[model samples]
Target: MYHAESFAAMGWETYIVGYKGAKLIPSLLQVPHVRELYLPQPPAFIANLPRLLFLLWAPYKILFQALTVLSTLLGELPYAPEFILVQNPPSIPTLALVQLCARLTGSKLVIDWHNLGYSILALRLGASNPVVGLAKMFEKTFGRKAYAHLFVTHAMKGVLVRDWKLLGIKAVLHDRPPSHFHACEPTEIHDLFSRLDLRPAGEDFLPPSSPPLSTPFTRLRDLPPSSLSPAFAATLPDRREDRPALVVSSTSWTADEDFAVLLNAMAFYEKRARAVNSPPKENPQKGDKHDRLPKMLVIVTGKGPLREKFTQDIDECQKLWQWVRCVPMWLEAADYPLLLGSADLGVSLHLSSSKLDLPMKIVDMFGCGLPVCALGFDCLSELVGEGNGRVFKDAGGLAAECETVLKGFPHAPELEKLKQGLVLQKSPTAGEKWNTWAEEWDRVVKPIVTHRPGVE
Candidate 1:
């Protein structure tokens, strides 16, 4: 969507042909020169087959997707585009089919390499798995000879080039948050929470077999439909001072992110929080129930395959937790950025499938001027090189970092230091600060997109 938006803004007649069921924003749908074309989704009975059956049906699924993609590319477009820009790592049928489409249509293929698809498959099946070996071969066979290649990290570029002996115009285009991710002022924060007052939408977030996960967060609410819906009064941290330290995290509830690490860390923090010396002990008669450390309200946003299981775990764990509360809620497109901007801190559990890639979540957090404590991986230093965030190896290490950084909670000096570092992390364009998604996109990708392939 970001790439298509950028292309449309640059006056390209862009079309985002994706599978149906993808929840795209209305703004993207209504963009001037951009169009949406969706491929039909398979029946739920076929799509939701058990793991073994799903594997057995993989070949058919791939064939169906390939045919649809080719049809969309060849028949659905208003006219043949000069370039067919595609993202990699969904490299199975999409890459191979797109390659074939590019050849048939006589268009240039520009592949944005996010990560190696084989490495991601390897995360589920071991590295030595035969399926993984075949996928690597598949990706390598079709990954070469692009018109221009854009990568999220320089490390990914270097490794793929060396291994696959790729020949193309290669560039590293680091992910940058768009303009909407800026920090909110106190008044803006209050207004956002006020407008986003919670409502019950059990059908969206609850399991059909079970009663709505009586937990606070599973009830997903709509923004536009309920924008004027009578504001049912629910517990909202409307006042910034009165609220616990608001921590935000997002996930897709997938194996790539080990949410268990975060759960364990929060459990440790909960125990420590309970053991803290409180003013209530000293002033029992006055009934001042205050502690040196502030309570933490961590709200995780995003819905995915693994969400149901993880939410259940949080539900079980929160029963024993007092000082720390972990709530999993899916926010609407408009409200997501607002919550990120209003958050006191951000946490990332994104473990890259290929260690060469970086997480865009932290970039979004940095865009919101929210300090982060990210789960460590090999390429994390690339993003955290400026000391804008801290990295931890495991649950214990993450717990230690949380205790170290958020010691004073709402008035945490260490967190403030990190936020300040994020503010100072800027780029100079003609000696002026110009560090936004649009500018950076123009700086790196625009040149490649416009350059003649014949040019040296």
Candidate 2:
């Protein structure tokens, strides 16, 4: 969606071809002037069948899907497109077929490599499997055929050059959130919370009773409600003026993320909070407030296979800690930005599939001015640093970091410094960055599209 919008902003006509799935939010289809071609999708049961069974049927499925994509391009496009950009991962037969179609149409093929197909297969089927070896050869052969390549990180580019010997006009194109996500107003946060039922009516759970932070951007409340997804919504605490410190984490509920580590850290934080807030029985004081200890609400978003188990674990932990609230949710696309804006801090447990790709979620969090506590990765320092957040090696380290942030909340000077650091972090607007990228893309493909003698 970001790429499509960026190209559209540059006055280029754009079209998106993708599968129709439950996770595809309808609002995305509303991007102005951009046509969409949705391929038929198999039923959920078939798509989610046992790994072996799904693999057995994959070849035929891929052929049918590829043919459908090719036919759609031929029939719907008034003329052959000058360029075709395709995402990779399930690259095996898809990229190969797309390359064939691009050749037939005289379009320049640009492969955006997100992850190697063989690496994904190896992760699931074991690195030593014979099929994994075959997949590596298949991906390499087609991957190098692209007219140009776009990588999400420099680390990925280095790996491809070193490991696969892929050479072409390649550059890093980091993911970024839309400008609207950068600075949101308090009323907009409140209104979104109300519409999403993120907080029950009459409840007062807003952050500490201080003036809302100010930013240079326009307030979201002035925008129409039609911009938000009407289908699904999640609740948050209602009272912004006195709400607990907000810690938010979004996950895909897969093995790549060790949710157990986060759960353990939360448990440790609860234990420490209990110890600190325990009453001094010897000097019984009168008229003491019942809830003097600072509280925290940890909202974990995203749905996946491990969601149920992790939610149960969180529920069990919450039973013992009154001051800690853990809410697990699945959010629609529109609600995501508002949710991030409402958070005081972000936590990410993503163990990258490749050290090269950075977490898009963290980028969005930074756009919202939310500091992060991310699990360390080889290239994480490029995004996270002293002011914005910390990197942790284990549950113990993560727990300690969480404690430090929580203990310093509600006017701690150290927490204020972290906020200042978050504000200082800057990058070019998505439009400027994408426009520069589009220029590079044009340079790489113009000759190929115009000077090629004939279609292969």
Instruction: List TM-scores for all candidates, in order.
Output: 0.86, 0.80
lDDT string for model 1 (1-456, tens) is 888888888988999888765467645666788888998775556555665686678788888878888888899998888889999878988889888888988898999998889988787667997888999999999998888888888789888889888878888888888877889865466556545533322223222321121222222223454445466533222233434677889887777999899899989888877776343566656522333566777888898878888888888887766677777888877778788898888899989998888888888888888889998888788787435888888998887777777777666788888887777775352222327788778878787778743322
State the lDDT of candidate 2 residue by residue for 1-456, as single tens digits: 666655555566788778764443344455565777787764455455677887788677777777777777887787888778888877867777777878899987878887677876776678888888888888888888677777777788888878878756666666656666654566566555545533311123333222223111112223334664666332222333335677889987876788988988877777877776777778656323433335777889888878999978877766666566778877887778888987777999987766677787888888788888999989887678898898998888887887776564555454567777766555334333323334444443333434542211
lDDT of 2 at 4: 66
| Model 1 alpha-carbon drift over 4 Å, by segment | 25-30, 43-51, 195-239, 279-291, 427-434, 452-456
TM-score of 2: 0.80
lDDT of 2 at 235: 26
Candidate 1 Cα lDDT to native: 0.76
What's the count of clashing pairs in each model shown? 0, 10
